[model samples]
Target: MRVIEVEHFEAWRAAARELLRDGVPAGDVDFCSPSTQKSLFGDESDDGGRALAAREAAARQRRGGVTVPPDFLKRARMVACHRDEHRWNLLYRVLWRLTTAEPNLLHVAFDDDVRRFDLMAKSVGRDAHKAQAFVRFRRIETEDGEQFVAWHRPDHRILRLVGPFFSRRFKSMRWTILTPDESASWDGAALTYGPGAPASAAPSADDLDEMWRSYYRSIFNPARIKLAMMRREMPVRYWAALPETQIIPEILAEAPARVAAMLKYGASGTRAVSAAEFLPEARDLESLARAAAGCRGCELCERATQTVFGRGPSTARLVLVGEQPGDQEDRHGEPFIGPAGEVLNHALVTAGLARDEVYLTNAVKHFHWEPRGKQRLHKKPPSRAISACRPWLEAEMTAVAPRVLVCLGVTAAQAVLGRDTRALKTRGVPFASEWCERTIITWHPAASLRARTDEERRRIARELAEHLRVAACA
Candidate 1:
């Protein structure tokens, strides 16, 4: 047996090439680190001399170079970063097979050696990603200036892979990230490496940490808590170094009571008046629309350009409720005048119904959006926002008293029907609502506009027209 000691990936590749050139089979070679001992089987008399001669000849030869698939080299490099001591041997064995036996060995999914290498590489990659996401930097005072320091514990040697990500994100700051196996430091202009460090070398707490924990606690939405998903995304193993984790237990303990309180009172718990409180007790449709213009029942009214109320004949038999107004609709103070409205008008004409024959409004009257550069991008309103605006929608339903109420999307369907009703599952099905005799669920015109392909858009438009035809018949 021939024992080859290699310290790193490049060293292993050089040694493996020499051994392969010398015609030394994998079974006769014992690849290991410099500190490991040789196998009990011992080396042959001429093996060392032959390997030395082959190494010298390879250093002199400049003809054909070692060739392997690009993916194999990538996997080999990632596997080399693993903590497994046998990783070198495994990679060299696979390299030998790729060069001599099977050129396509790495492509075989069921191959034991390929599967092992893939698992090791995947583990190392995952460790790298986790390290990038979970590292928290703390401010520290030093002789030169203030420097940020962070300490992390990763399962693999991934300091090199995750270092660039931190450098790109915090390029203006001087920081050092220390792990048990390695350390990386960025000095504002460049990144430098150092030896490993202990957890005590990092600061335990700082003044900013308390503020960070407070922000974390404030943003924890009790209504949308999903314990399984939270644990899956941010595992408990990484909670030790995160300052926000100090309050996770407290947040979780109070979540149930907070959600109950939100349900008992309003979502914000400050608004006690019903939708009727926002209105001026006017029974006429125009008076109700004017009253809705000054509504502060929800936070959306604060950001919207103006309140978009329903338009069309109040004597119409069909009332259509949409999710909310769009950017153009919010500016123009009308629903169904934007691109989505164009699609709805076309579908209504195709379904043999005139636009003036139906009253049009929305479940939520205001436009909800987040600013993107100079434009306002539409944002989906949360359930609380919908609930706050439901009173206005209920008033519209009471005033119109249409023979057929058509809900255009999930938000509108949930507003008219119960919250548990799903629009996709209830489409084309007529259901009874408290405000109307018959209510039909259908795809919103915006859904057809968002379709991925022409074929999909045509299909959605056809389905929407069919539902509208049913509503027209009613």
Candidate 2:
């Protein structure tokens, strides 16, 4: 058997292609990689590799190249990252079958080769996910600038696949992630890789360690402690290099006493969850938007198509808060872009405010609607939903910190003010509020759309514009 040595997916591709060109049978070749370094048999001579390349070159001149499905190439890359000794052999078998015998071999799920490689690929995928979740970066002080270092041991060679994930997330900050197999560094503009490193290469602690542990302690719910389930999801093998895991044992130990104290002090047996709990520790607007996309704060999120998050400049001096997303806004995943939005856009122009200059958001991010035949009719959000989603609005308000906050209608007013707040009664007037320097209540453009008469609609629309004028100049 000819010994074929490859260290990565590209090397495997090159060797496999040459072997296939030379009509070498899959079972006749010894597939080897760094993961399979200690072989039962000795290594082959350099002449063997040279002879195989020459044979492949001669065969290429005699016949055209073979073809396989795009799906095979995609799966082969993931399988190559797996540490299975037989991974290379299984991949070649699948490729050979796809090119020589059954082109649709992958579609046959029960085929032993197909199922085996699929399982290997899935394991690699899970390893990549764990690498993303468990890799905790620690701050490292350098004379140059801010830097962070994290160490993790993934079950597979997944640095290539997960490097972009980290770079996209912490792009603004300079950081390095070290693993037993490889290392990656991001300098804000580009990502580069180097040799592997030991766990000791990563820093043990940073200034933020205690602060992070305190935050974790504060958020830990004794009533919701599920040690087995948590361990299963975040396996113990990944506990090292994760500073938060250092405190997990103590937290778990204190669970019973904490639960007992909570019950004795009139605390509910179940913890009260809100959007606040769903918010990411990061305070950036983009991070907040990504976290909101998966929000399960209330039942409304279940029915809504998606979370229609706020949009605009972060430095805006004015903030416009509405009720909830409309049907169009829900489908599009933006704050305002539907018919009612058009009216509001016109009113903004008439009031000397640019749509992109001020922050546009809502009390409820989801669209609360009921099916009416083929169309979905907008429904007013219940008080509970408004309460459940207020945390998101509060987060946005805090992030924006607007000089003036304009409540589009009663729902927005109640969300910012109190549940009993009346919009029409308090329209066109600004009041001191904790969230903003001045809070103004106004009739929503949607209210004007639902008016009984054209004259009355025009009256409300003009009144709405007048209130917006006051907000713009405030």
Local accuracy by lDDT, each model: 0.82, 0.82
Candidate 1 lands at a TM-score of 0.51
Q: How many backbone collisions does model 1 have?
A: 0
Count residue pairs with overlapping backbones in model 2.
Answer: 0
Candidate 2 per-residue C-alpha lDDT over 40-70 given as tens digits, one digit per residue, 9 for 90 to 100 = 1224466745765575576557556688888
- List the candidate 2 regions with Cα displacement exceeding 4 Å: 34-66, 256-383, 390-474
**RMSD (Å) of each candidate, 1 decimal:** 18.4, 13.4
lDDT of 1 by residue, 210-275 (tens): 866865664466777778967865789889899999898899999999879766766566763345
TM-score of each: 0.51, 0.57
Model 2: how far residue 395 lies from native, Å? 4.9
Clashing residue pairs in candidate 2, if any? Answer: none
Q: Pick the candidate with the highest TM-score.
A: 2
- For model 2 the TM-score comes to 0.57
